[model samples]
Target: MASSDDAPRVFQPLPGRTVDRSAAYHALLRELLSLVGAEAPADDEPRWQDRARLAVRKAVKARTVQGPVPEEWFEPMMRATVHEPDPSFVGHLVVPAVAAWGLRPVLLALLDHLDNGTPADVAGVARAWYHTGGAPEAEHEASRDLYRRYQHTALRRFVTLDDLDARRCLLPGLRLQHRSFPPDMHELVDQAVHLARTSDDDYLRHRVEIQTRLT
Candidate 1:
């Protein structure tokens, strides 16, 4: 019988080949997203609730693997579906963007697990990525907000004038003045602050500053 030591590694790092790893990571993410029926259509609107249900199903099945799947892998999808009344942002433009953002780290962690042939510590993987400058800091919250609003307006169904007003009030700059930031951005800023506090690296500190400034 093959011992644990004899088990093949799920992922092997190629020497001096960052692009190879990135390409592989994206491929695996697409595969997983497809597995959960989350592939977006190029010419049609996506069904966000369907995608969320599929993600929950996949995450549940993944638990049968040897170790824990990272919470980040599945939490956002589940959370997005937890809203009262409609649970789904079926036509909400923000849903897809937020889903993609939340899924990136989850996909990387999943890839690491597959490559390692073992359960992976996603937080450790995230720390490594941040330390290596793999994570891109958002340069401008205003730009992101504007883009999200534009997308929402363009894609949303049954959007009312009240909804537009609500969106305007939720813009980052406006919310900052009211001391009310979006939950996701608040969490990200908190994480960056925590990371900066724990690490002495100058670059990490600068990255944290850039992220926090946007928040």
Candidate 2:
């Protein structure tokens, strides 16, 4: 990855080529992670770290993945840095204007699917695309609303954080906020704690514990 000073130049917008789209995605992922100095596991035992690294790379460049940013908003997004409420793990999840413009189509696709189908069908499709484990229609709709309301922050996490875990965090927050499910933040924290223990990431575990205590 290049230095921060080179960010503006290294990430200048260009017309995306069909051939290099994947490469560009990898480049974007590497550049994004470089901002946080995230490291992969040692060459010998590389596993989660390596997968996480690759996932980040794949996500940004993923032609299949899409978002709701506007076409005309490209210039603004290029100038935009990942702001607060974005996950602290990956600081400033910035993207070029072209990428932002490209995202509108993707988001439109999702919305189209939602509006075109029944709520149940929308949930099924969103679950498959987002890899959520087939949540109920109401549950998924609540998440969709949360994703809509806090898109930028959610995108930062969605783009970089391991998809499963990020979704785990999001599910509870969304459920609590909209569906009134889980009763309150305490239930959300409890659920998060269980998920943290499901992983080996001490940092996430600590965060869950702290959230548990606070809630």
Candidate 3:
């Protein structure tokens, strides 16, 4: 989400990019495998997280000591077929990208992250949303069709319902003009503008109106 006068709209098709497991993923798996008496962590201290994973280790360790499930249960639970058999997904979510996305709490998280994120990182957050929304390339210069695609409905709801400052600061900011969408597509925008005008988390009456009016 570069703030260039012209933001590049690079949409990846199915099998877009290979997933890279971050340190965070490793930390969680290490903790889980240790809890099941499967794989002891190679290090005494956590290789990644300090407080959060340590807390989880303590809790799960406490539960395991209580023996809620028998050791016999661990073998079959490890073989659960409900899970995907993809080699890429064997231990963690290492799937390649696709145009489609599930409406997950992560979407809400991106909106929440925009306000507090550093100036350097703000565009990254916005880019994540734009890509996750599957927003296609600009259809109209005057009105960037951010919400025209059916795939973008979840994104539309998120951007519209998000706080004015975040909407103004992050994705689809003042630089971009919002298209007037169909009632079905635009319903959330109306609600958000109404909420904004009514002083709900909107300090300026025209916080949202001003953006929509952009040429």
Which one is best on lDDT?
3
- Cα deviation of 127 in candidate 2 (Å)? 21
**lDDT score of residue 30 within candidate 1:** 44
TM-score winner, 1 or 2 = 2
lDDT by residue for model 1 (1-215), tens: 11121111122111121112333333434444554445433324375434444454444444425355444545333222221112122113222323344434433332333233211121112112211111233322213433233222211211121222122211211112113334545543344355444555444344434434543
Candidate 3 structure quality by residue, lDDT tens digits, 86-134: 2223212110111112223233344344444433223334444444332
- Of candidates 3 and 2, the better by TM-score: 3
Candidate 1 accuracy as TM-score: 0.20
Ranking by TM-score: 3, 2, 1
Candidate 3 — worst ten consecutive residues by lDDT sum?
91-100
Sorted by lDDT (best first), the order is 3, 2, 1
Worst ten in a row by lDDT for model 2? 5-14
The residue-by-residue lDDT of candidate 2 on 1-215, one tens digit each, is 21221011111111111122334334444444454244543446645334444544344445325654333433222212211111222222222222433333333443444345333323222322232212234443434543353323332333234444334333322222222232333444344446555666554444444434432
True lDDT of residue 31, candidate 3: 44
Provide the overall lDDT of each model, using Cα atoms, as 2-decimal numbers: 0.30, 0.33, 0.36
